[model samples]
Target: MTPLLVAVDVGTTSARAGVLTRDGAVLARAEAPIEIRREGAERAEHKSENIWASVCRAVAEAIAKAGADTETIVGIAFDATCSLVVRAKDGAPLAVGSDGDPDWDTIVWLDHRALAEAEEARATGHRVLDFAGGALSPEMEIPKLMWLKRNLPKTWQRAGYMFDLADFLSWKACGSLERSQSTLTSKWSFLAHEAEGWPADFLTAMGLEDLRERASLPRHASPIGHPLGTLTAKAARELGLPKTVIVGTGMVDAHAGALGVLGAFANQPETIDRHLGLIAGTSSAVTALATEPRPAPGVWGPYFGAVLPGIWLSEGGQSASGAALDHIIRVHSSGAAPTPLMHAEIINRITQLRSQCDDLAPRLHVLPDFHGNRSPFANPKALGVISGMSLDASFDGLCKLYWRGAVAIALGVRQILETLNARGYAIDTLHVTGGHTRNPLLMELYADATGCTVHELPDADAMLLGTAMAAATGAGLYPSLADAATAMRHASVTREPDRSRRALYDRDYAVFLKMHAHRAEIEAML
Candidate 1:
């Protein structure tokens, strides 16, 4: 029988599953939406029950679609958003809300209710903060945990398990409380390269001394792609897989996407550092691989062994790329709500608009930090800036706005690449995956604005494919993740930068930087 692996990607809005053979062929894929509840502008929550249910449904459907025998499914792997999942001692979901809604048991990655807590965490000036992008953001686990400890003491007292969503899924599947190095080092401030991994004194300084034991987190994190254990009978039945299936350690979804896109170059070892992974979805995560730790100011990482062992990863991205675009369309005078059809219509119109005009929104400029800057600046309070807008509320105006917004998002990438190149990375090639691939305009600007060769691989689900590679290794199909990555790397359709437009983008990038400086000046005055 042909060995197969199931890779599940639990994203912000959906749980997507793909079944693949050991040789990188995606047999079938399926997705199911996971509901998010937002009561306040800063509050976003998900029910772990709902997320796991979505995962199971998506996996079952994908397996059925593949028409593969369940016995042949030898391993499974998971990658999920860095959401914080709270559970009671007995394993029931613990409400993270004041209303005590069990359905709101998880705090989402983008939730900013912990903004004050993040600031407080940063104020501690602990050594752990150094690993956390030189400052902490509300998105990381520690701040969210601090928020729970301070605001919901009762919930905090009752909560026995605090799982990064990925670890939660892995534990649910294989009955292992082992966290992944990718999850721990990248988001939870567990330094994988360090001997003690856990910063006991740091947590104690924040009065979160019990967090380590509360999470039931092991002393050491499992390496990415390592098999933790076999799936429990209950999980096996729920996922429609065989009991023989081993479950591999999981990672953050974007990290997994990084693995998917950049892992292909792992065999090269020499030039992989020249490649960056731009995984865009509701939010964007810009992942850069490094053989050694080269920590730069304001970027989220230089995390050791976060994606691949013996390699460090630095992450920089816009907090609001897709969401910014969605907001642009929703609030525009000429636009209705943003639907798939409307988005496609805008994309189609922009194609024609660019044909007529050399630059669609040459005068229009956008600062796409609406949800705040997640990279090279690490300021969560950052706001979006629009330089050109008028009473022109025509549909054409909206398309132009969308076009400029897309370019600005790409320019944001340019700004990060500047910082990356300044630090040490010779990032000439960007391997892009996820939602940005679906937008032709964004894909084009990714190359033109950033002046990097864009590699868009087969449009297959790279996150799932990356997870599958891990699963394949865990199932004994390969000796290590490096070998699996080498075998499973999918070829890409390459797009080179339009060098002729370098002058245009250089000017735009200048304006982008000036705008950021201006915003900072105004904030300083206030």
Candidate 2:
């Protein structure tokens, strides 16, 4: 019997598990939604127990669906959001709430309630802050921790372990406390580009020196491929699998998407130098492979061994993409609660209506940075701006504004690519994967806006496939991540930029830039 590998991807909204063959074919898959609750601007949280339950359910469902011999499963790999997870010494949930129920322990990555703390840390001029786009936003771990320390002092004092969601999942399954280089270097300011461990002074400066003594953390590549002992008997039974299955170290969810696609393309003869991976989901990230580490001032990383091992990665992205679009529709409404079904239909109807216009309209321009800018200029205080809006309250008009926002996001991506290209990083084609890729208008807009062809994987589950590939490696089926990607990844369609829309986008991009600059001015004034 052919051996199978398991890949579990824990995302912001869902947990997915897939059973796959050595050659990259997915035999069965399962998905479970991860609950999210947002309190206010930049405040998002998830229950750790809920997340773990989702993982177990997804894995069990996938195994049952595959109908394969359970003993054939050789290895498992995991991936999840870079969100922060806090637990007490005995592994009990430690609430991070200011005054709500004392059960919320997970701080969703989108949570920016730590903005004040992050800004204060930035003002300290810590050298470690340079790796994170020259400024640390509340999105990273330390600031969030600091917020907990100041706002939830009692909880902070009692907390025994803190983890990036990806690492937390790994620990839960195999009892390994090793951290991924992808997770620490990208979000926790761990030095991957350098040969040393975490900078002592940097931690002290950020008022997080206490973590320097933590015993559970492991370096990026040190504990990389070791089986974190087999899945615990408890985790195994919960997942409906044998306890002896090997569990390998995992990666950040987007890096898993990159590992699933870009890792493979980097080795290909045709797409090596300039290929970029756009993982568009709740947020958007632009990932590119680099030969050596090169830092972009306001963008994240030059993270070594973060995505594909040994190759450097420079990541640029919008802090909000799909979420921003959702916010756009919600707030633009005068006095209406847009149901999920209604909201989606509104977007579709708007998209179809926009298709009827002459492909050029001056009545819409939207700045979708409602969650603050995450790339090119690491300003977390940046606000969204809308221009060219008429008094028209029609849904079609709303859709046009929505499309303009999407187009503006693409333009922002182009700006990052331009920055990278200007600084000597070559970007040739874009390989995109994620939930937003399902939108034809979004893909076309991105291609036209960036003047590059957009290639999406045929599988539609690149993140899961990426994790599965890692399992394939741990099972000794593939030599490396690059090898796994090539065998498993398949391009379904390529969307090329249209010349007619190119000129219109060019003019519109200028206005987009202007609107952002004006917003900055207004924000500073306030």
Candidate 3:
């Protein structure tokens, strides 16, 4: 049996697997829905067992679909959201929320239960904050860890492992406790540019001085493409794959998608800095790499080795984009969220309505900070606002709102680009992947709204192929990730910005900034 590479991506809603040839051709892909428990506005959680089981099922299904024998799966790598996973010293899942359900061991990346803690951490004014866009968000690990220590003392005291979701998968696959450099540098506030990596003084200031020791973290992070070890026998048996499979250090899922999208430009520095990779889904991440560090205010990073070795990466995004669009549809007078059929109908409805007016949703505007502003304003307290809502509650009204919502999401992307550009990046092109690519309106708005040339990934599942590239690199099929990615990248379809729509979006962008300023005014008055 010839060896194959496997990529596993654990997203907010599902666990997906791709079995691919070494050259990056996807042979088979499968997905399994995982469980999430939302306990009000502040908390969201997932069962570790459910995630792991879903991942195993997905991998097995993919291998079966590919008709690849278990022994032929020679290399495996994982990428997942930056959720926090906690386990007891004996390896049992521990509760992360107030429900006290031990199975709910993962704090989802979008959870905002740590807002106060995040603000407190930001107040520390530590040097580490400089790397994290001069301020940190509730979404980061430190704030979440601080929240656990304060509110769930018993769980925190009993926990021995705190793995970022990606590292959790790698550990589950190979029994290696090493963390990924990408994960540590990007989310855990490890100062990758510094020789020491972990900022001990910063952690001490946050009262989590014992985190590294308690979590059993390695003194140094393993680079993204570094091989961890052969798959453990238990893991192999569970996955129904061969023990000979090599495992690689993993990264934040969006970063992996960025790697897949932008890796071809690795050697071309001038081209790389001008191209941003947008991986949008339940949320969105805009990633750009620079050979020289260029720290932008409110954008996370200038993070060294977060995306590629020796390249500094900066990330900016909306805390909610696709998710916000979904929420708009659900809460509209139209009632509950549309089923896939209904959503498609809504897209059709929007398209038809646009035919009626050259200026669809022209007066309507939305600030998509429903989940808090993750970047370009590092503020977690930001709330979403919708201007110019009419009293009409008909399906037509819903369509108008939906159209504006899509435009707003793209406008959010535009705002982020401005921040990046101001800080030294001249991004005139955006490579977009993920679920957002499925929405025709968003695809158009991204280019028209941002006035940037857009490239749609030819692969429907680029994240999976990206993790496959990592597996190939770790397996020594490619000398480095750059080599593997360049070899594996697919052709992209280009979309030039619509000059005709530019003026309309310019007015919308003005309203977008005004909304922020208006928000501040109201807050001060309150």
Candidate 4:
């Protein structure tokens, strides 16, 4: 029988799984939705059990679809959002929020309930902050833990183990508490480069002195692709796989996508800095890898071995990209729901409008920070700004706003790219994957607005492909993660920037920056 691998990716709303061969060709793929309970604008929660169940379903369905026997699968790996999952000593769920329901045990990564805590962490100005873009983000684990401890004291007291969602999934699979270096270094403020990964002083300063003990975190983080042991009998039964299948250390979903696209250059580290990975979905993350640490303000990382071993990764992101576009459609009078068909209709209309007039909405401008700025500003408090709007509530008017909104999203990426370039990276190529790839308008803008060549991977899901590479390494199919990546890498369809539209976007970018200044000025007046 041919050896196969299962790669699971749990995102904000869904769990996806794929079955791939040793050479990285995906045989089958499946997805299952995981519920998110939203309490308010800033708070979101997930039941860890539900997420695991979703993963199991996805994996089982994927295996069945591929018509592969359970005995053929030799490896499994996971990638998830950096959500925090809490559990009691007896392995029961522990609530993470004000709600007393233990079932709501996971804090979603996009939860901003810890904004104050993040600001408090940023105020410390500790050396640890240097690795995290000189500011802490509420989206990271530390601040969220602080929020849990402060707001849910009873839950905090009951907490016995805490895990990054990816690590949590691994534990579920193999009953191991080992955490991934990718999750620790990138989100939990663990210094992968230091002798002591966890900074005690920083934890003490944040009143989380007992965090390591409370969370059951280990002194050392396992590198991505390290074998954590085979799945437990129970896990094997649940996932419809054999217990002999190895479970590999996982990573943040964006990092997994990074590996999928950029892993091809694992052996050619010298030119890796010229390429970047843009995992654009509900949000947008720009990942750049380099031989040495390249830290920049508002850009998270310089994380050692977060993705590839011995490589330093720098991540800059927009907190809302596709989400912002969805919000625009929802709020517009002519729009109903932001469904795929609706988005297609809007894009189709916008294209028609653009052909009629090169400048579709010349006056309309948007600063796409509706969910706060994550890159180049690091301001979670930052609010989106929009200028030039008329009382036109027609469908055409909605299309105009939507088109401009997409442009703003791309412009935000351009700003992040400029920041990365200034901070020792020579990135001129963007390897894009995820939901945004399906959006023609955003795909075009990603190249044209950023003046960078955008390479979209073929039909294979990059996130799953990246995790499959890790699984292939752990399964002993490859000597190293780099070898797995080099063997499994896929070719991409490239889009070059349209230079003729450069002057127009240049003007828009100027307006985008000016809008930022103006928003700041207006906020300062308050």
Instruction: State TM-scores per candidate.
Output: 0.96, 0.90, 0.94, 0.96
Q: In model 2, what is the error at residue 203, expressed in angstroms? A: 1.2
- Give the root-mean-square deviation of each candidate in angstroms: 1.7, 3.0, 2.1, 1.6
Q: List residue ranges in candidate 4 displaced over 4 A.
A: none
lDDT of 3 by residue, 434-469 (tens): 887788889999999999999998465768877888
**Residue runs of model 1 more than 4 Å from their true location after superposition:** none
Candidate that scores best on lDDT: 4
- Model 2 per-residue lDDT tens digits across residues 186-229: 78888876777687787777677776333245644432334566
Q: lDDT, candidate 1, residue 53? A: 92
Pull out the clashing pairs in model 3.
none
lDDT of 1 at 356: 92
As a whole number from 0 to 100, the lDDT of residue 345 in candidate 2 is: 79
Q: What's the lDDT for residue 160 in model 3?
A: 92
lDDT, residue 178, model 3: 92
Report residue 184 deviation for candidate 2 (angstroms).
1.3
Residue-by-residue lDDT tens digits, candidate 4, 82-143: 99999998899998767588999999998989989988998989988889999888889999
| Error of model 2, residue 117, in angstroms | 2.3
- Please list the C-alpha lDDT of all candidates, in the order they appear: 0.88, 0.78, 0.87, 0.92
